[model samples]
Target: MMAAHGAPWFAGWGTLALVNAGLAQGKNRSGLGWFLLSLLLGPLATLLLVLLPKVRDRMF
Candidate 1:
């Protein structure tokens, strides 16, 4: 039934995922991993990303 609305419903989530991916990369984390996680966990993944500790002593 929800499918009737199509991807539009989740379009916001997709945008959020892209933004989260960039945030993950900035934090020296895996952008792809966060992108995948956002697909399943949605906004919750974003919250987790926000709360996760940043990598110290970055190689680059």
Candidate 2:
């Protein structure tokens, strides 16, 4: 088990990455790209993703 002091830090970042991935996908962006970016940029990436435009569905 991780140290008590380190548990929250790891869990918080992990969860943030997951949510970021989903947000990216929702925006029609690359989920994997956002997930990796979030691991480093954290909240900054989230803000950017939120400001990005959603992909429009092309129904031909």
Best by lDDT: 2
Error of 2 at 57 (Å): 4.8
Tens-digit lDDT track for model 2 on 1-60?
656998899899989999999999988788999999999999999999988889887798
Can you tell me which runs of candidate 2 are displaced by over 4 Å?
Answer: 57-60
Stretches of candidate 1 above 4 Å error? 1-4, 58-60
Per-residue lDDT of candidate 1, residues 1-60 (tens digit): 456576786898899999999999989899999999998888999999999999876576
Cα lDDT listed for each candidate: 0.90, 0.92
Q: Estimate the TM-score of every prediction.
A: 0.80, 0.82
Ten consecutive residues with minimal summed lDDT in candidate 1?
1-10
Global lDDT of model 1: 0.90
Model 2 lDDT, full chain set: 0.92
* Clashing residue pairs for model 2: none
Candidate 2 matches the true fold with a TM-score of 0.82
